[model samples]
Target: MINKNVFNKTKVSLIKINVAVVVSFFIIFSIFIYSYFKGLTYNSVDRNLNDELENITVQLTSSAIFSPIVLKDPSNMVYIYEGDRVKYYTRNGYFEDMLPKFRENKKNSFFTYTENGYTFRELSLEIGKYKIQIIRNIDAQINSFKQLIYVFVIGIIIAIIITYFIALYLTKKALIPIETAWNNQAKFVQDASHELRTPISIVSSKLESMLRSPNSTISDEVELIADAMKETRRIKKMINDLLCLTKEDSITTLNKEEVNIEQLINEISNDYLDIAEVQNKKFNINLNAENKIIITDKNKLRQLILIFIDNAFKYTNKNDIICINLTEEGRDIIISIEDSGIGIKDDEISNIFDRFFRSENVRSKDIDGSGIGLSIAKMLSTSLDIDISVKSKLNEFTKFNLIIHNK
Candidate 1:
């Protein structure tokens, strides 16, 4: 399991990074959208004012009698000035006080003016001796632009809230594999230590027994010394197995070549035949596969087969039959190793490949094993793309089949 504090810190860091990136993108996008619409809103109003100014100028220069009532848009107001005096105006009564004082210097220009809470866009144009000003109320368009800003602010806030939860979810999902690997590593270390403790304790106790008999001759302590040496060799073998597993874990490449499958099996059978004769056991081999050549890591394949054959020898007594059979099934090769020995229970077969996992029957018989051999075999099988299956019944027989795809 991952530590609580470390997990939380890592999750928070990831969430913060994700949210920060989203927030920056949203803010920039919102600014661009707001500016584009704002420009469009004001440009429409300016274009309308320009059209009105042009119409007024054309009427004044056409020698037609200009009448304010002839204006098509009622919202627009026109004022004609001459020498700082209002000569003609569009609106009736004393509405001149509401309009700005006209100036001759301000010509062909547009500006915004607010008076008594009313906003207007004004255009000034000089025609002959007349100074003309055109004004339009723009309070509605201003209110609409303000609403657009409000929408963007609210939209950005909502998007950020959604992004926070999304970032949190994705961060947890990404860390699951890391957490699992860490927990597995912790368990592996714990199991390895537990397996090493027993042999070390036996060796230490044997040495202590010898030290107490210091006055005795070497012949008198022969059994004690032998026991200690046996345990020491067991410890050494366990260490080597552990080192092999660790190395296999770190390997990312395979040294593959064409290997004659029948020849490889015969070589292993020859070596184990000598062991069987010395131990008073029966050994047999049946090779029936026609296509014998396979492309794989030959050394790893040899080691895998040796693990199964060695286990058969360890678990069986005198006169027990151990057989290796190779046959072809379609385009795949199947290798079977069968032993009439102390077999495994049906329930324990599934867990035989776990590291340091020994069955109750094996433990009861006091078999000499570290229980890591099958685990290493499983790793090698996976690396070589070989599928393994087991069949066994307690106190009867055990069989393991390795399926090698020809492709």
Candidate 2:
């Protein structure tokens, strides 16, 4: 089981990192957007001021009279100075008394002038002998910029809130697989320890029995020595199975090659025939597929089939029948291993592939198995993209079907 506190801490850490990245990105983006729009707004005002100054300069130079229409807009105030004396003047409403002082050195320059809580953009230009000054009120543009700043601040806050929730959801979703793997790994360690402890204890007890009778010769204590050695071999085999599982877990890719399905099954069947004859059990193989070649990891396929066949023999008694059938349906090649044995209960069928799982019947009968064989088979089938299914009835028959898709 996963510790709740640790899981929550992990989730919080991920969410914090995600939210921090989002906040940093949005802050930089907000600054860029504000700066760009602000410059654009102020540049529009400056361009307008320059245009008005040009028009006024052209009118004064080409004609003797100044056009009143040019100064009709009250937001703008214009002054023309000739040698420090006012040559021409137009007063804007409410800003008539706040005119800027003329400067001889300020030629073709733009500046901001503030007076009586009012702000203006002023442009000074020299037109021949006369100096022209144009001031435009920019209080409204400044207010609009302030509003834009407020909008950005509020937008960022809203974005942060939404992003926090989204990050929370995604982090939880991402941790599910990790949590499952953690629990599975913990269970696997516990089971492995339990399995190893039993045989080790038995071997220790057998050896202690032999030690207690030190005077007995080797021939007199042969049974105890044999039992100890048997348990030791069982321990060795279990450790090898565990290592196999670890190796399989670390394998990310498979070595696939052309494998002749018929030849492979025939070879496996030949080996099992000898075992069947010794055990007084009947063994048969039926290969019906027209196309027997498949692209797959051949070693893995062989190991997977051997597991089923070995299991079939383990649960069956003398004179029982074990059959291996190979057939084709559509693009799939089906290989089945069936036996007249003490079959699995319906409820336990789903759990047969779980690591260290043994059915109640097998446990009660004390059948020899480490319970890792089917789990390894399951892993191999998954890697080979083969589908395995079972049909069984308790105390009657058990059948395992492996469906290999032709690629």
Q: By TM-score, who's the top model here?
A: 2
Quote the lDDT for 69 in model 1.
Answer: 26
Cα deviation of 336, candidate 2, in Å: 1.3
* Per-residue lDDT value at 315 in model 1: 94
Clashing pairs in 1: none
lDDT of 1 by residue, 1-407 (tens): 45879989999999999988998998899889888887886688778877777777776767445444245566778887766777666763324475665645656877776766777787888877888888787888778878988887898889889998999899999988888888878878888899889989999998999888889888999998899899999999999999988897543258999999999999989998889999999999999999999999899899999999999999998999999999999999999999999999988999999988999999998989898999999899998999999999888899999999989
- RMSD list, candidates in order: 3.6, 2.6
- TM-score against native, each model: 0.84, 0.90
For candidate 2, write residues 185-295 as lDDT tens digits.
Answer: 999999999989988999999888888998999999899889888889988988988988889754326889999999999998898888999999999999999999999
Best by lDDT: 2
Q: What C-alpha lDDT values do all the predictions have? A: 0.86, 0.87
Model 2 TM-score? Answer: 0.90
Lowest lDDT sum, 10 consecutive residues, model 2, at 64-73
